[model samples]
Target: MADFGEILRSIGEFGLFQKVILFALCFPNAILPFQFASVFFIQSDPERHCNTDWILRADPDLSTGEQLNLTLPREEDGSFSRCRMFVPVDWNISDIREHRLNETTGCRDRWVYTNSLYEATIVTDFDLVCDQANLLEVAQTVLMAGILIGCLLFGPFAESFGRKRAAQVPVVVMVIFTATTGLCPNFYLYLASQFMVGIGYGGYRLNGVILATEWIGVSRRALGACGTQLFGAVGQIILASMIYFVRDWRLAQLLTAAPLAVVVVYIWFVPESARWLLDRGRTEEAKQLITKVAAINKRPVSDSLLEKIVVKETEKKGGIIILIQSSVLRKYFFTIILAWFSLNITYYCLSFNVGNFGLNIFLTQAMFGLTELPAHILCIWLLEALGRQVSIMSTLLIGGLLCLLILAVPQGNAAAVTALATSGRFFANWAGSICNVYVQELFPTSVRQTASGLGSIASRAGGLLAPLLNMLAMYHSSIPTIVFGSLTLISGALCILLPETRRRELPDSTDEAEANR
Candidate 1:
């Protein structure tokens, strides 16, 4: 019997059928960046001060400046205290002026934000400032938790069910919850909706790559993997533009999610993986789909060629257990997990903290988004020229070094800091694009989606930590960078031990996967 790759060549490798599937799968990726990185705009911390409107009653004709001066205290930096207000008194405005009220307390009537880039964010709407600031981290953490859970749930699911269901269901869930996210009246509801969105994000992200790669020929697999990231990069750039104009978190959330509704309809029309179908003893269905693909690509194949396509089925089902049973697969799994963890934490830490670079947030974010285009484009070449192992190692190593170099930058040098961080992001993005293809290639087809999902779980765990690590900046500004950079370097060095998968056919069984070394 011929292997699936041989069958793919006989039908059409990068023909109309594969192109349609790739577009169907990759188009949603454009929306993913909005779901993944929207927090940067939605949770932005703007300048604020305590609301001291009680003083307005004291002097009805007082100017805005006079009201703030009388009602709020100044910080040591000479700025009005954001969370403190002078204790209100019934004394006349003249007496209040005489006393120059020194007594202060926490904001009694909420806070008033000024010079805000966003008209309203979760931070402003929920008053997530001062003592409540930690909630923003909590919200992001909740989203990450949902993503982790999705990975854990969907990894085995794709193996058990078809990849088509795994891909389609997530889009439906994302559309519902993302739209719901905009309607959330409180922080708690918003967190719930975001969690569901994260779940959808986690599942779709894993399945989309698996489905696309499984259908394409070995020669085009790099394009299948890296091309989706190109769309994701486009999504980020579009997100920056949307946030720049809309300036409202709810409206932006609604707009970003709108495209996925169309995806929900079209995704159902895309066919399931022929490889997956054959593995599950649905040979007739696989044969029919293969025939359909051949027809669409205008590459007619003989009936005998279709009949010869078969998958070697194992009595032992594929799952996490199979991974633990094979020592070689275990090594690949753990090493890739660490690599994924390092990449995600470093990438997201820089992403979520785009504002801290001291550059304009929109411009900085746009530049950051723009970096992914060339990164993925270069990744296609690097994967082909340097091979997967070298590409992963080199990008991670260089990205880490650039992150560490930020420590040498002077305190107020925004230009230098932004430059280094953006450069690090460029390499990190390249490493990320390679890792996406490399992880899929490292495991066998029976457990490919499962392994990818497991790897994503580690990635999401890293993402979960990113916000908490950003919290460490309070202890010291350099702490997060130190941790991100060190882990990245270690991950890069560890990739040296992994077997290269470039130019090799994907492993179809455990024995084939173990034999790659």
Candidate 2:
């Protein structure tokens, strides 16, 4: 009797059938960037100042420019004060014209923004500047919190529900909430909507990857996994281009949400995992998909071949708790957990480093996104050439070492620092990209979604921490990089302890994984 890999080989592991699945799954992955990183555009704050309404009203004859120049104080850089103005006084033109106002007050009613590229933004709509500026970070943090929460929820849910159900539900939720986020009237409602998008995206994220992972055979699995991230990189670039035209945050939200809704209808075209089907004791359903896929791939096999395949029916259902109960699996799970956390921190740290590069923020961000595509292509080959464990360990090692190199370079040479940092980001992208493929190979199909979600929780945890950690540069320029580099180094050391799972049959349960070990 042949194993599943043998069966896959006979039926074409990466035929036209698998290619369709890859294309469909890549849609959601591309949309992933819009949820996680597009905030850089949506929340962009431009030149603004306290509302001149009181100043105009006080001196009825004062022209708009005259009122602003006379009433508001100038910042050290010669820009008008953004959050403050002189208390309106009865003083005549000469007193105000000479900038002689003694008492100053914060903006009483509202603020004004200069002509900007954006029609409006969350910052302008809700006045999220000054004291309110922190709320913007609050909204982003809430979304990350939702992502971490969703990571916890989806793992067990996907195991209990089928992968198809798991994949579609979040896409629907994401589409609805993401559209609603555009219509949000107030900041609080917008926060709620962003949090929901995060939840749905977090749930969709791992399950989609797992669904694609289960569909393809081992040799091409790394390729499929890395391809999703390439799509995400493309998504970022596409999103940037769209925002360049749309200019309004709400319209950008509506536009991006529409594509994911379209994908929801099309996700039905892809097949559920046969491995997941058999795990739930739906052997007939499993066999049906197998037959269909085999036919579609143009590789005909005898019914007797399908009948000869025997699967163990266990009473235990997979979940996070059950996964940790096995000691060997515990080692594997936690070590990968650290890798997930470290890679995420390192990746986001570089991603958010766009402003620090002494280049245009938008251009730097696009460069960062564009950098991931080739890195992912290289990473896929590295996973195949160097094998999983080696690829992950070496990439993390290289990324960490490069980040540390930034510590040695003199601070004034922006070009050298940026070049080294971009190089570091490239390697870190590969490290995170490979983890997408590597973690799935370690766990069995039963708890695969659960384990993947658990890993994502660690990743989101790192995401949540990165913004705060990056601020450590106020203490020392290298502090944040030093911390990020050290964590990846530690994670690399953890990677050294795991077993290699190259060109191996997919494990269906913890016992199966241990037995293979």
Query: What is the per-residue lDDT of model 2 for residues 429-513, given as tens digits with 9 covering 90 to 100?
Result: 7888878887887887767777888898999898777777776776887889999999988898789878888778888667778
Model 2: weakest 10-residue lDDT segment is 36-45
Candidate of highest lDDT: 1
Residues 327-394, model 1: lDDT tens digits: 99999999999999998999989988888888998899899889889999989888999899999999
Global local distance difference test of model 2: 0.79
In angstroms, the error of model 1 at 274 is: 0.7
Candidate 2's displacement at residue 186, Å, is 2.2
Error of 2 at 130 (Å): 1.8
Q: Pick the candidate with the highest TM-score.
A: 1
Clash pairs, model 1 backbone:
none
